[model samples]
Target: MPRVVSALAALALLAWSVPSAALQVRLVPPTPRQGDTVMLFVGGTKGARDVEGSLGGQRLAFFPYGAEYAALAGVDLETKPGKVPWRIGLVDGVGTPRKAAGILTIKAAGFPVQRLTLPDGMVNLDPQSEQRAANEAARLRTLYDTVTPERLWRGRFTQPVASRKPGEGFGFRRVINGQPRMPHAGIDYSADRGTPVVASNRGRVALLGEFFFAGRLVALDHGLGLYTLYFHLDGVAVTEGELVERGQTVGTVGTSGRSTGPHLHFAAQLGRARVNPPDLYTLPVRD
Candidate 1:
């Protein structure tokens, strides 16, 4: 009887002393390359509906759970060199409280970042371009205000439709008339004028309009201010305010505006900040 009592007490003590690693999340790349997108993996715990994820000092941009993992966007891993802290915690569907966190390291790419150029005769347009850029910047601010990082953490991302071959580089520097310009904002995929364009993930149609540079465009809001823009589209498949599913056809590729050939300028945006979509695609999503 005494032996039995001692065994039970010892077992209870071991249970109390050993900490349960409820969830094991590590930023896959301890030292992520510049312009790299960091992905977090969860282990040990299961059945979580959403996982709150944050990078640097930012709050959770998307909540990912289930078999699929959620990801953050607009990370310029090159700009901020050094250790980047990340945190993840589970969200209880019924209001039970539980959470966890971990740190991630970031290393410098050491390569010179790319830049674009502007036109020569546009030298005198400084005030004009500055005003326009400022206006656009302000618009982005408004968008980011509504799309907090926390809201994006509500769901996991669905697998993106394969492009096979992407056309444009995400941050390729451009030289216009021997003057530097803003680096390219998104990735471009070569396709026929009418090649179908699908949603990278589940999202709502946020903006459907034309712009001087973007041409006929469609912006899908994937909650939490996370959005994807399809520019130089030959046609729009969905209307404004329409809820689109992952892989749903939203538009067709084209060379509608300021383009040399038929292609789709696929861009991903987190709030007002532009991020490289290819980075998200490169990360291991199935895990």
Candidate 2:
């Protein structure tokens, strides 16, 4: 009876010494390339509730994954190649807060320089047109920078064009009219005039208007600081504030904005990261 009691006491002591399983997460591609997207996989919270987290300061949008959850991490060109941090917080059943954190390493992505010799007037706009371009850029910045905390998209994103191809790549160091210009920040698709262009994902139409450079354009907000823009559109099928599904026709290809030929300029913005539109196509979706 004394031996039995000793064994019981030893077992109890071991249990007390062992720490509880932590509610923590691991970063997929723990080191992400600039302009890429990574997945944050939260583990040990199989049955836990109210899990929340952030990767490199950008708020994460979690989706159910069996018992645990996962979130998408966007790494933009602005993310300098270096180490960053990841964090998570959860309230346990007893209302106690649990927290965890780790570091993320960012790898460099090199972009190529592009020299486009468009007409002098097209490259060097007059004062009025320059002001219009500035205003258009400001309007877009405000929209992309706006944070809509809800996740409005489902499934992986799709290309706006049927071919799913790109013309000039994103992050092109542009030199136009012998003057350096802001790097081309979007993926261009060569399409016939009147060809259909669809929403990259389910989203609400945020803006539809004519601009000096983009021409008739449509902007869609997929919430969670994710926004997609379709430029040089010939026809706008959706109106501002309209909800559109993935692959739904939002506009038609056109040489509307300052363009030499009909094409679709499809761009995606995740918070401040002007990432490649196709990067969104690779993000996993939740049911």
Highest-scoring model, lDDT: 2
Compared with the true structure, all predictions reach lDDT values of 0.64, 0.82
Encode model 2's per-residue lDDT on 173-213: one tens digit a residue: 88886788887778899988999999888999998999988
Backbone clashes per model, in order? 18, 0
Q: 1-287 in candidate 1: lDDT tens per residue?
A: 99999999999989767755566655655566655555556665445555666776666554444543455544662356666666766654443445766556655554434543334334335677657646655654565556734332123443333455744576666656556666777777877778788887777787777654676888877776677788888889999888888778988887775566788888776644556676555555543
Best by TM-score: 2
Which regions of candidate 1 fall more than 4 Å away from where they truly are?
1-23, 43-53, 62-64, 67-74, 88-103, 108-137, 148-165
Ten residues in sequence with the least summed lDDT for candidate 1 = 152-161
- For candidate 1, the TM-score is 0.70
lDDT at 58, model 2: 87
Q: Give the backbone clash total of model 1.
A: 18
